[model samples]
Target: MAVLLHLDSSLFPLENSGSRQLTDAFRRTWQEAHPQGSVIYRDLAADRVPHLDAATVAADTLPPLRRQLIAEFEKADVVLIGAPMYNFTVPSTLKAWLDQIILAGRTFGEGVPASGKRVVVASSRGGSYRPGTPRAGFEFDTNYLEKVLGDALGLRVEVITRELTLAPVTPAMAALIPQAEESARQSLLRAAESAREHAALVS
Candidate 1:
């Protein structure tokens, strides 16, 4: 059976988190498409991986947790990540998880074990970051992931972005609330569509 590794890094709960909703939509669609597939889920905010340390880097042997994380990543047929931008970048917990699994000689370097695997990232940010937007240059979350997960690790990276998420709560962003809602709706649709498309390739 196919295996999906899902990682959620949103700090807020489902009801309040746009990234969670997008990822959940993808997961649900994926489940429907692969009735017997297995899902491995991690809520990074609640169970954060330790940041990489000197001991992990200098040790003669791989740390147990790092080994396990790598194994899990290699086992996955697909990876779904809910990455809500915090301070113009990915959550620290997500970064920690990346540090654990990105083994140079294994998952990254020559003969990359994760090559060709599909990773759909549900990326949500408070403001617009598309090209031509005023804050486009400030976008580091999805762009960083594309480089690390795709260019470096060789995973096939696909991102569904939900922007202007702060519009609902910030008084100054009130005028963009409609755009935020539309962005969210489109993100959910894109997530489901992408999940089904990827699921068809699992077998």
Candidate 2:
């Protein structure tokens, strides 16, 4: 059976954040499309993966830790990440999780080697940062994820952003919430479809 790795970094679960809801919706759609597939879930909030520290950095270079994480990464064909942008970047928890998975020679190597993996990042933010918008400068989180996962790790990457714009709610911000949520849901569905197609091609 195909494997789908699900990583949820939202502190609020599905109750408070539009991002989690969007991810959940995507999960359901993906499950429907690939009924025989199995999902492995990693909840970063409840079971936090430690950030790369002195110990972890050292461990990463060692053969044991490198083999362990690489084994995990190799087992999954599809990776689904539910992340919330914090202060114009990925949440520290998600970054920590990424640190563990990104082994220089394991996930990638010289000559642009491909891992033949697919990753979907579902992110939520409180502002509008789409390109061409004035606030687009705040898009470091999504961009960084794409660059790191795709270029560095050699995983095909897709992103779905859920703009809350509801917190710190000004009248203008409040007006965009409904449309933004709808857009996010649609994007997530599209990502799910893409994942299904990619999984089929790989299988």
Candidate 3:
């Protein structure tokens, strides 16, 4: 049966997390298109995956949580990840989940199918960090994930980003509120479209 696997790493509660909210929008539409399909949900912030240690060296000997994560990825036709930019990079919790899934002998290796799965990355940024901006070079979340998911693992990856999340609350960014609202609307539109398009792959 077709399955959707989702990971949410936002530190804030789901009601207040932009990344989570975007992912939810995608999931809702996706489910409407495939109501009979199964769904797997993992909340990394509430139940963080442990960092790699001696016990995590081999795929066959992975801990229960790590093994479960990999198994879910293996069965998933669609994977949704909530990646809120933290410290200019992916949240450490999300990174930990990636480390567990990117096993050389399992998820990746010579002669393996180059990812039959579709991956959606819902990215949320607190500030405006696009190209040509003063801090453009510091934007790392989407770039890093694209390389790892698209280049490294060969999954079909689509990234939809919501920026300037702090504009309404940060005194310094109050001037950007209008732009932030537009960005949010555009991001939601793109995410919904993407979900509708890719929902066919698993439906």
User: Top TM-score: which candidate number?
Assistant: 1
Clashing pairs in 2: none
Candidate 3 matches the true fold with a TM-score of 0.95
Worst 10 residues of 1 by lDDT: 106-115
Give Cα-based local distance difference scores for all models.
0.94, 0.76, 0.89
Residue-level lDDT for 109 in candidate 1: 89
Q: How many residue pairs clash in all the candidates, one count each?
A: 0, 0, 0
The lDDT-based order of candidates, best leading, equals: 1, 3, 2
Task: Report the poorest 10 consecutive residues by lDDT, candidate 3.
Answer: 53-62
Q: What's the lDDT of the predicted structure labeled candidate 3?
A: 0.89
Ordered by TM-score, highest first, the candidates read: 1, 3, 2
CA shift of 43, model 1, Å: 0.5
For model 3, the superposed segments whose C-alpha errors exceed 4 Å read: 58-60
Q: Which one wins by TM-score: 2 or 3?
A: 3
Give model 1 RMSD, 1 decimal: 1.1
